[model samples]
Target: MSKPIIATTSLAGCFGCHMAILDIDARILQLIDLVEFNKSPIDDIKTFTKECDIGIIEGGCCNSENIHVLKEFRKHCKILISLGECAIMGGLPALRNGIPVKECLEEAYLNGPTVGRNTERILPNDEELPMILDKVYPCHEIVKIDYYLPGCPPKADLIWAAVVALVTGDELNIPYELVKFD
Candidate 1:
């Protein structure tokens, strides 16, 4: 039988969730034996080459490009898992949710303490750049997320348990400690 395929991506959050996946350490070898990676940064695959069994998203939607990628994942994968606090609840990036995008952009590109060198006072207007969203949004707000693994970056054990359960058709068994943040 063919192995289940998994894809993953990072959007607006820190890449910490991806790093947490690596925290599983040697068990990653077991994980590799159980599934195939597609369209994942881990394998350096930039686009989906085939339909995937699972899609793991690590961050929130903060720009048009993020929305496009999330939608593509929804289209190509049968199950979508939000794999960290950012994916589940918009995390640190959503701190800007109360602020206007224009003010944020101005502070970042024209008036913040670090912008002294922006003599042209230009804001990024290139068409190639992804349009910024009004605010960061959790993955579920934008797509039909099938599951959520919540944490600043979910515990490695929780990630491993969830992936194994899904791939193996076993019930997920997460310990209370694994789910606890404080």
Candidate 2:
């Protein structure tokens, strides 16, 4: 029998989720034996070449491009998972919800102490830059997410459990210690 195909992406996040995936240690070998990866940073695959059985997304949407990619992920995968607190509720990025985009930009680019020596005071108006949304949006708010793994970076075992359950048709048992918020 062929292995299930998995795809993953990180958006508007710290990339800690991906690191956690690696934290499963040697068990990753077991994962490799169970499934294949596509369009994920792990494989350096930039585009979807085939339909995927599962898609794991980390982080929330904070710009037009993130939304676009997320929608595409939903269309291409049979089971889409919101793999972190960011994907579940916009996480730390959602802290910007109450703050206006204009103010955020000024704080990040023009006025913040760390932005020093910005005599030009430009706020990245290039055409290549994506348009920032007024507020970060959780993945479920934008598309139909089939599952959610709530964590700042979701413990490695939690991720492993979720993936194994889906691929092997087993019920998932999330340990109490692994289910955390903050």
Candidate 3:
């Protein structure tokens, strides 16, 4: 039988979740034996070449490009798993939820301490730029997420367990120690 195909992407948050996948370490050899990857940053595939069995998403939607990629994942994958706190609840990026987008932009480009001397004070307005959303949104808020692994970056064992269970049709057995969000 052909191995299940998996795909993954990072949207708005740090790539910590992808790092956690690598943290699976030596067991990644086992993972390779169990499944094949498609349209993933791990393989540097920019677009889906075929349908995938599972799609693991690592971050939340913070801009138009993120939404587009997520919607494409939903269309191409049979099961979609939100792989970290960022994918499940918008994580640190959602801290801007309470602030107005204009204020955020001004602070980032025109007034904040990091801003360089901008005599013209130009905000990025190139049509090529992906339009930023007013607030970061969890994956579930935008797409029909089939499962979620919640943590700043979910434990490597937890990720392993979930992937194995889905691939083998076994019930997920997460250890108590792996349940901590931190």
Candidate 4:
């Protein structure tokens, strides 16, 4: 029988969750026998595969591209998982939501020690740029999320458990040990 198709995508994140996915390591070979990666590390960008049984989305939606990718994933995948804290809770980048969008952009392009000077001449919010949402929203808020795995970057075990449960058609019961911060 053919293995299930799994598609993973990263939004505006550091790609740490994708790295953690590899943490499955030796077991990944076994997983390879049981799963086909349709998107992710090897495939930088892809139209969502209709054959995808599981879609893992890392990072939060901070830009139009991220939102577009997410909606496409939802339309294609049977089960969509919000992977890692960024997807689940907005992550570190979401902290910027507290600051004015202009201020944040200025910090990066107009006021930062190095790049600030040149940005003054740069056009402020234009048609080319996506508008920032008034507040950061978790994946579920934008689209229905089938499952969420939380953690700055979820542990390999969590990813493994989520997938194993998914492949076997079992419910994922996250243990307390995995969630306890201390």
| Candidate 1 root-mean-square deviation in Å | 1.0
lDDT of each residue in 1-182, candidate 1, tens digit only: 99999999999979999999999999999999999999998999999999999999999999999999999999999999998888998999999999999999999999898787888889999999999999999999998999999887789999999999999999987888898441
lDDT of every predicted structure (CA atoms): 0.94, 0.92, 0.94, 0.80
How many clashing pairs per prediction, in order? Answer: 0, 0, 0, 0
Q: Which digits, one per residue and each the tens of the lDDT, describe model 4 over residues 1-182?
A: 77888999988778998898988989998888778888666566466545688999998888876788788888878899998888888888899887887787767776677774573457356887776666666788888899888776788888898899989889879887665221
Best by lDDT: 3
Candidate 1, position 97, lDDT: 97
Off by over 4 Å in 2: none
For candidate 1, the per-residue lDDT at 163 reads: 95
Model 3 misplaced regions, further than 4 Å: none
Candidate 3 TM-score, true structure as reference: 0.98
Greater-TM-score candidate between 2 and 3? 3
- Extract clashing residue pairs from model 4: none
Candidate 3 per-residue C-alpha lDDT over 1-182 given as tens digits, one digit per residue, 9 for 90 to 100: 99999999999879999999999999999999999999999999999998999999999999999999999999999999999988998989999998999999999999999899888989999999999999999999999999989888899889999999999999987878897665
Q: How many steric clashes does model 1 contain? A: 0
Q: Is candidate 2 or candidate 4 better by TM-score?
A: 2
TM-score of each: 0.97, 0.96, 0.98, 0.87
Best by TM-score: 3
